[model samples]
Structure formats: C-alpha cells, structure tokens
Target: MSTAPLPDLVKTVIVPARPDRAFAVFVEEVGAWWPLAGFSVGGASSSVAFERDPDGRATHLVETLADRGTAVWGAVTRWDPPHALAFTWHPGERADAATRVEVTFTPDGDATAVVLTHSGWEARADGEGARTRYDTGWELVLKPFAEHAGSSR
Candidate 1:
C-alpha cells in the first residue's frame, strides 16, 4: 500500500485590484496591514517588513518588536513580479527545518485572485498543529490584504 501525500494548507482571496497592484501591496507595503502583534515571533506588538538587501544578495521577511528587536520569519525564494512569490518560512525555528509558502496572483478583469499555499510541513515535528494554526493565521493575513490592497485602487 502507498501512503498519500501530505495536504497543503491554502487560503484564497479576491482583491479588488489588478494583479500588479495586489502584488505591490503584499510585497512593498506588508508592514501596513500585517498583524504584527499576535502573529509574529515576538508574540507582542511589532511591525512586519519585507526588506530586500541593497546588495541584491538577500531578502528578509522580518518582525520587529520594541522589546524583542528583530526576528527572521523567512527568506525570499522567488520574486516574480505580480505573479508569484515563494519563501522559506521558519519562524522561531532552525533554517534547516523551514517550510515553504507560495503566493500567486491571477488577474481577473480589474480584480486579482490571490492564492496562498503553505506546504512542506512534513519536516516539522508539530506539522499537524502548525498546519491548523496557519489555517486561521493565513486567513487573518488575507483579510487585511484584501482590504488594504482593495482600497489602494
């Protein structure tokens, strides 16, 4: 008998803007809408940012809290504009144990369909719980994303 593959956790939303615009809001202005307090490494109030290295060698998605300083949530794996973005997500864990999160933007007339998939949980010990946690967490991220990205139009 063959074991089935692990299921990916997914969240999809439709933003009231073009794909490029939705992409910009997600990448360029993540700090504006990302809920930094309850959803970050610090577990307190903080700011989230997608900071690209000036030397073009690295990009970090980090959480910055007043007392906790900065925490690395992930590193950028793909940066395809207005289409797809993928990253390694290892918040509060070793880099070697990181999972992958991929978000894609599809254009639908003036609106944009945003689909986010977080996979590779088989690497973690608490993969099942993590997946459940992210199911709600990702929804939190998407609500603000849709609102913020929509208003930018």
Candidate 2:
C-alpha cells in the first residue's frame, strides 16, 4: 500500500465585529472574504457558498480563461451559531480524502476572536502541498475579513 503524509493547517484572527455578526458574515458573505486566486478549483472563484444545515454542502465555483470548475469542499458537520462551525474540507485532487475544519468565534469583549483549525487530513501523495496552500490561503483570506469587519465597526 502507498503511504503519504496528511495535510493540516491552522489560522486565527480577531475581528471588530461581534461574535454573532462575525459568524453570520463568515457563512453568508463568504464571497467577500475568500481569497480565491491561486486556491480556486479553477482560475477565479466566482463564489463561495456555505449551507448552514447539518450535512449541507459548501461549494466553490470558478471560471478560468477557457474552462469552468466547481468543487464541493465538504458538508457541515457541526453548526453552532455565534460559537462554532465545523465541516469537512477537501480540494480538487484531494477530494476523495477527508479532513475537518473548525471555525470558532469567541466573544472578546466587543470584538470576536476567530480561531480556525484544519485537521484530520488523510495522508496522500499531495497532502503536504495541500497543507502548504492552506497555510498561505488562510492568512490571505482572514486578513481581508478582519479588515472588512474592522472598517465596518
């Protein structure tokens, strides 16, 4: 049997929005904060949609120079409003493998602390590459989200 390493990444951010509002924006306004340039299923991701229901799907749609791509990242495994959102995460070639992602929003006085954990990756040939991509991706995406929340405050 082939053996490969599993992928994992984590990121955190503090946003000015309250916990409830921050959580809402994360699920509802994903298109505004997701950095979909190099990490998209295709070229440019047109939208990132999250369905809140248990087992609901999270999809990313993209359009390239000559082709379009759509990918189902995973289903919602846990959904606790204003506190936690957990789901499976897999991208492109790693689709068959499963991973878990948890985003927690904690009340920090008036602001919110957003902590993200990406783990449970099944070791595969490209697992390390996926980990690397997510490392940079989370930073990129969270930066904008934090800024957006801060500006609106």
Candidate 3:
C-alpha cells in the first residue's frame, strides 16, 4: 500500500510566451505577480530576488507595519534557465521542514507549458495541506503570468 496521495506534486499551466520570456518573469518579475496577502513574511514584500546560479538564493524581503520587523523567505536548490527552476519554500514555517518546488518549461509552438512540481512534502505531517496550498498557488501564479504574457504580445 502506498502512503502517497492520488495526485503527485506536479501542477502544469500553458503560458502564451516563449520559454525564455516565461522563465524571465519567474526569475525577474516575481514580485509583480506574487500575492502579498499570501506571503509568509507577515508583511508585504518590498522586493523578490532570485539568484540564477546553482545553489543561489531566492529571497523574499518584507517589512512589517511597525517598521521594526523585517523578514526574508526562500532557498534555492536548482536553477536552469529556459528549462527548470527548483527551490525550497519555507515562508513562515521551519526552513528545514520546507518542501521543494520544481518548475519546468517546455516549448509548445508559440507558447510554453509551465509544469510546477512541489514535492518533498511526503515527510511532513501537513503534507496534504501543503499540497492543497500549492495546488491553489499555481493557479494564482499562472493566471497573472498568462495575462501579462498575453498583453505583451
């Protein structure tokens, strides 16, 4: 018997942009699409940064209302342009217990299909919840990406 759930960690969306453009938005323009209300920093993030090199850092910096508290989120596991991006998602939770998020982009005609797989939650007690969160998160992320891509053309 398998302890894993029915659906694996993969969530895919087809965007109306080439692989490079789609990849750039995820790395460069993430702050524009990231939902401030859902951030783990307990504040609205001022800037989101993603380092492209392997083992690089993907950081989300947010400032609290009191101006006395500032928080940063994320860790990078893999970075491959126009192909895949993988990182750790800790937000407000324990960084060590965070799950891994892998996103891949494959060319599909004039568009690119984005496949996001957030796994490594198999060991967490709240794996089901985490999966549910990502399931919705992908929709949030992809919707704006698609809209933005459509407008650009």
The top-ranked prediction according to TM-score is: 1
Ranking by lDDT: 1, 2, 3
* lDDT for each candidate structure: 0.85, 0.70, 0.68
For model 2 the local lDDT of residue 20 reads 86
Q: Any residue pairs clashing in model 2, and if so which?
A: none
Better TM-score candidate (1, 2): 1
lDDT of 3 by residue, 56-133 (tens): 444433323334554435576676787888777766676666677788989999999998887777646678877887
* Candidate 2 accuracy as lDDT: 0.70
Residue-by-residue lDDT tens digits, candidate 2, 81-102: 8799887776564545766789
Which pairs of residues have clashing backbones in candidate 3? none
Tens digits of per-residue lDDT, candidate 1, 76-141, equal 999888799999999888887788999999998889999999998887777878888999999997
Query: How much lDDT does candidate 3 score?
Result: 0.68
For each candidate in turn, the TM-score is 0.90, 0.78, 0.77
In model 1, the clashing pairs are none
Q: Which residue window of length 10 is worst by lDDT in model 3?
A: 57-66
Query: In model 1, what is the error at residue 9, expressed in angstroms?
Result: 1.1
